[model samples]
Target chain A: MQQSNAPWRTPALIIVAGCLIALLTFGVRAGFGLFLEPMSQDQGWGREVFAFAIALQNLLWGLGQPFAGALADRYGSGRVLALGGLFYGLGVWLMAHAATPWQLQLSAGVLVGLGLAGASFAIALAAMSRAVSEERRSWVLGIGTAAGSLGQFLMVPLGQAFLAAYGWSTALTLLGCGVLLVIPLAGVLKGRAVAGGATSATTREQTLGEALREASGHGGYWYLTSGFFVCGFHVAFIATHLPAYLVDNGIAASTAAWALALVGLFNVIGSYSAGVLGGRYSKKYLLSSLYLTRAVVIAVFVLAPLSTVSVYLFAAAMGLLWLSTVPLTSGLVAQIFGPRYMATLFGIVFLSHQLGAFLGVWLGGYLFDNTGSYALVWWISVALGITSAILHWPIDERRVPRLANAAP
Target chain B: MTGHRHAALLLLAVLAAWSLLLGLALWQLRLNDEQAGKVVVLFPPAWDAQTHFERTLRAGGLVVGQAPLANLWVVYSEQAGFVGRLKDQGAWIAFQPAPFAIVTLGGCFSGPGALPPSFLKTRRLSGDRP
Candidate 1:
């Protein structure tokens, strides 16, 4: 890796700060599901409206990620992260006061979406990847992913407690304040992707256009992107609708809240394990296996009788698979293409993920409103998981010729 | 040495911030328990407006208003044990709406064209309760 000579720019500092940023950003985003019920009930709107807004948020996050990543590549992640934090905080603050669907779309969907693109895990992971050696890179990425899960675990309960005490509006306002902490930590992660013509041990000087074209031409990249779409779909669907589904089935609201928290908590172990294992195994195979396992877990949860025990069991089982794809998929991008433009390239992949998220969340609400049940969405999730497993199995894990030739 | 010290300081600061947030959330939740009178009443999905009205009246509570959800309503009563009465009358779930009043969002009960006079009366009654 290209090491900075500055005393404070140690790899440890970058990794620590980057992990914290990922934690805050992902943690805050994960808690949005807790608001869907209250917001929908208050507005007298169908689930579709809030789902559409959140779906739009995912779409915009995906749409803006490349631009955000490119800017982070050209300038530095710190500025992008700080700007994103401001927009994110404002978006949440505005979402609290949104009286109409359009206002909700603008604040929660557009502003927060764009803000997430700039301050998301993709940016933080890219910076962290460049800070470490290749041997330790995947493990570091896992740690960052784990931190994000930890945030979800901590923040969801906190958000629930806040909602219980202060109400939804005050809860969101307080959460917005929590997101602003990202700005001050941004200072530690200041440096462009190519500092003095080197990044992540690569000295190749490729322009932005070349990087995009090269990646676009690779079949594996497309496969990887498509597979990631399923990941997004499964995540957003469950996060948004699972609590409602449980409530409809006669579970207490507090149990539903704890169920989501359990998903986050268990994911901490799952993500870290996936990261450590990715370093020693085939990333493609690991990803393939993870998707296949997701299908089975969902199938069992839906087929079995609904009880608090089943719900908690399902949460724990699914938690192990949740967000576990992140480290391995990101590792593949860094491995195959080189980490020089990882923020931009991985941002594209993440865009696919967010697009899937958009569809999953929106479709869940639309389907439920029409049929009065989420059964079809669960079946669709199962089918997509199997297909994703197939899509990933054929990906060639080899580096492109350029990266191969440049390797010492 | 300096890098190690800087990293340690950052860790400490982050931990402190998180601890403070957790403490605040817990404390507020505790305080909310003391001021819980107004409750959110949920009925079965098939329940209609008349059913919600009949049920609330049966439970000896005034209907504050309905939320966006067809089966969910904001019910207010100064009568103690009113929540238990709601459960006795087939309410799916009745819990304190303390800080989560659905009507306060303005979409449901804000403008003059919004809720009825009875809703306004009910709101006035429950205003100081929670």
Candidate 2:
């Protein structure tokens, strides 16, 4: 890992700032579902209209990740993050005034999605990795990732209370104000990645073209990318639809909020634990096990009773497994290719995740509207979990030969 | 070294504060879950929830006041379980029942259409002197 000696760019400051960015960005994205029923009811729109808009948001976010990532890799993440924060706040504020689906598509879908691409874990983790030692790398990554869950734990309940007290419009505007904090912190994240040519103890200088071409040709990269799709599918479906699913199953609306909060709370532990384990274990195997465990957890939850106790238990179980995949997946990229091109490489992988998210959220609403059940998408999530489990098992974890030369 | 330590301390302090707020929020939600049964209910002008849900209300609560033209009734339930029982039997549920269930997001609320003039008599927190 490489970093300048600026006081503000120290590992401690980077970790603190990076974690906050991840917390705010990922946290807000996770609770958009709590607004679904209220917003739909207020506008007299069916679930499909809101679901499709969120689906577009997911798709656009995924679409934006690669470009945002490339730019961050070329320049620094500070400006990208600031710009992303501005757009994010703008998007949230616009969502408050949107009367039609088209307005929602522009604000909630396009702008928020694009903004998320800039400030998300993909960039923050990549940048933070450059500030720490290789030995502390995976653990640091986990810390940064866990902050997202912490944010969710903090934000979802607040969102519920706001939506319940004020209308969705006012709640959205307040949340928008919350996002504006990210702009200044982006400056705190000002640090450059050490290119491959820079003399670092264990890093090599690889040009953008070289890194992209190398990654494009690697079979393991494809496997890693493809496997991440299930993660997106599972997370988006649960986040966007779980509140309504709880309401449908005779649980209170607050239970939905509490359930999501439970997922967020437990996820902090899960992500950090996964990080610690990733540092000691093979990332590929850890990923495979995580995916398999998710399939089993979801299957068990489906078979169990839907009472509040059972729902809390399921949220705890799923939360432990939820975004736990993030560290392992990103760590695998750094492990195999080296951290030099991690932002760009991981961004591509995240794109696949977002594509899966699009299908999961849109299809969740579509299927529910047509069939009056989310059972089909639930099954799809289970099947894809198994598929990703199998996909990760064979990914080669060895560093690329060209970049394998000793860092010094 | 002290500067780094101070930075770390500040981060920890911020995190602790956020955790406190978050814990309090969750604690508040769980605590308020029981207290939200306090509400103003208005049935159809000619109808009554107390008389209609008489057996359930008698077992669980007391009707504090009534306004016939407003089609409104203030039912103060000392029992927190009162609302849950009403919800269990699929009784009408509303966020603000006096102004005619303006925002019923959960449970059964008949339908979502314009409330009749008889049910639209709005009230303050101190409603129906009867």
Candidate 3:
């Protein structure tokens, strides 16, 4: 049964706000790749400089997530989200004015990264998960992920138009202002997790340290963490590099832009389906299958001839698997450990994902600069995908003893 | 269940709105294609007026107009492959001017309501004649 500790903080309201937050935060970040070409060209810097800043941004975002989740788990999501929005908006706004590499790193890398940690859809998922009953949690997580993908679908073109019309500086400033919209939405997402609701509550309140210790000892948690790393690597690499790769292969810039957007478009369907299916099936198995599918998809895309049609096809196929892992992976966390410290535990799992992202983005730039192709990195992604698929196969999906004992 | 239904309704509404916006953008692009020989050129933000002017001339284009934003210019050229030339000369993006300018300027000013007067001025300046 769903318990309402705060009648005002209805599940509907939380879901809505969480969805919007996911839209703004993920949408803005997804379009960062659009900046890479123009911004690097304008600054007379190599792709590595811009890539390093973005990689650092991912690293910082991943690093800050657990702490931000801890804070959200402890105090409330509202304050964390508000502060994050401010940082995010300010970071992007400053990034527009950053002339030097160091300045870019400070603004785009540090501030925006931290902003994402707090304001990202993960926090929203956690909040939304706590709002609904156990049966609905997976589906809600899917809704949030799908909304974020929709943001990507919507924002990429808008970002491209902004870049095409106003230039990168004004476009970035506009996006910065857009991120500030998160602050108001955060208000409705206020309140920590309900003390004893559905599968989330323990008979006795567990300390954060104990929660951390318990999660660390769980082998399934480590497997989930390791598997998520591949998701981060694949997504970050493709989102950051695919536009350039497509353009390099004789596709028009406009087509390339739309191809990236198409990924986001298809992702909405994939994420929602994953969410809906995750509720009905074993999340671990779903995760395993999603990874295996990614490996095969990437292998096929790479082996196929590059054309406008192939690019769009690859994007649509890849987008389906893109963030679909998010809901299932996070769902498994909520399922096994419960949603009590989901924000924190998921944050740690997300950290591995970010580490993969950092490597993916940085390595893509470095390899391209040295080898003049993204071919090597593409194969690495495929290998990692296969490895992650294998890792998730043996995970135990049952609820932890503590939560199982507390369950009615 | 009611909450879930409401959330689903909202999600559907969002997807619908996004699809609508995409349709509008594609329609605008098609409309923009009907008018040719004019391209919006985006230069680096750090570039000055002299650089933009010289670059446009170098790319075989005549400077037709400028947007409020510093680095975006409206250029006209009778020469073939004008957009390609602009790309060669380091223009970040070269595209049909109206769709991008109108959408961006409209966005900057909030909406179509605040758009007309500024847009009219831009149109006059952007014209091959004026």
Candidate 4:
């Protein structure tokens, strides 16, 4: 097989394209919370209603990621992203017009979630990895993750401004329009699938059963799955409930928005730093340290004085720690198993994250409705964070001995 | 081999670009920080509130100060409409009615049957016990 002209150019272009796609997908999704109160109030619905929908969206997103990744690995990422963009656009539009809770759930939860699975980092990273050298994969993965973080930062402020200017409904419609921007970028990923004689000779070489069997049989995969669950729990819990918690605590809405924004802003640093550090250190240890730090941070935050300064301090500190795990965790999977089936393996691990996400997002609202406070949820997060730290600590990061000895 | 090297250089270029953009954003935030002002308002306790008031104050470019001798602390805003939770109090209330009025309710703060509708707007601040 002959290499393409400008080999590095194509890979770098692919990563950039992946970044753009990630930016659009996550950017819009992060601002879903800003719509919660307004949408609930307008429909005379409960916070649980909105929370449930978002939770479903998160679960579905998680469920879809690996499958999307698998499809991209077999078929092509460009098509997956293109289709995802369409579904994202349609889902956001449907959400804007949704009058019933079920309708909201269907639009925001199922459609948007599935859409994200296709266009998200799972697919993007896989595509980028195929284009780059093995040695640069971790750093490239970091760049891609940071791109999503950048999207969160840029889009949160943009979403806020849109909400302030156009109301939630119109804002969502505009965001849907922005999601369509991915359609064009998808073109870049076309015809870039890595070709292998072995892959083509055996149509069953990369079957879903094969991928599942490979991951399930591996001890490292379980650790990745368990550790990822904690990430989902922490992110979903914070994203879904932080604003309301701030409002409930007598903090102003603007400050809450900034808190959320700061989370994204600081994560830019955290994610990049994690990427760089992961390149230098053991990725698993870095992940363990991040989770432990998150546990410690949450404990200090809840126990400390409730002031604007303290909250901002907490946001900045946590933000720096947030999402840093993504590059490391994803990089480790690619390192241990290789990128051939990375999307599928990573997707399954992400499923655990989403399950945690499902519980975190749903339980936060449920407990709030039941007990009228976020205390239970915060305690749960602390426990989960500590547990995640423990889980990652024992993960064997060495390559699978079986795969290492197999014919190349 | 040469192609791989060029690819490596290109990847580095993209990384540099992304880092620069992030750095610019952080710099902009720092500049904005220097211009921010402090606003003070009284928050009543009784309402079981979270960080809403403080979040809103920060969003409005005001620094939330510590509680004064009275039960109320200074919010960065001079506006009367903002609501917040009182420190160590159980209920939430607005900041503008009167600072001295809130201080008078000190011991009875957040006690059942004592809070009026005004207090309902403000919840108790987290970690604050009355």
Candidate number with the higher lDDT (2 or 4) = 2
Better of 2 and 4 by TM-score: 2
Displacement of residue B18 (Cα, Å) in model 4 is: 14
Is model 1 an incorrect, acceptable, medium or high docking prediction?
incorrect
- For A1-408, candidate 3 gives per-residue lDDT tens digits of 232346787788888889989988877876676677678789998877876777677778888999999998888888788889999999999999989999998998899989999999878888889888788889999989888877766676676666665678988998899899899988888777656644445634688899999999999999999999888788777765665666566565556555655676788888988998999999998999999999998888878777788888888898788888989999999999888688899999998988787677679879877777778888898899899999999999998898888777
Clashing pairs in 2: A196-A204, A196-A205, A197-A205, A202-A407
Give the per-residue lDDT digits (tens) of candidate 2, residues B19-94: 7754443333332224435555434446555454573365365556542324455556667666555445444442
Provide the overall lDDT of each model, using Cα atoms, as 2-decimal numbers. Answer: 0.76, 0.70, 0.77, 0.67
Q: TM-score of each candidate?
A: 0.75, 0.74, 0.76, 0.71
Cα lDDT tens digits for candidate 1, A288-359: 999999998899888888789998999888888988899999999988887778889999998888778768
- TM-score of chain B for predicted candidate 2: 0.34
User: Could you give candidate 4's per-residue lDDT for residues A288-366 as a string of tens digits?
Assistant: 8899999998888888867799779988888888778888998898777666667777877777877876677678879
Q: List the candidates ranked by TM-score, beginning with the highest.
A: 3, 1, 2, 4
Fraction of true contacts reproduced, model 1?
A: 0.08
Q: Looking at candidate 1, what is the lDDT of residue A248?
A: 67
**Model 4 residue A49 CA deviation in Å:** 5.3
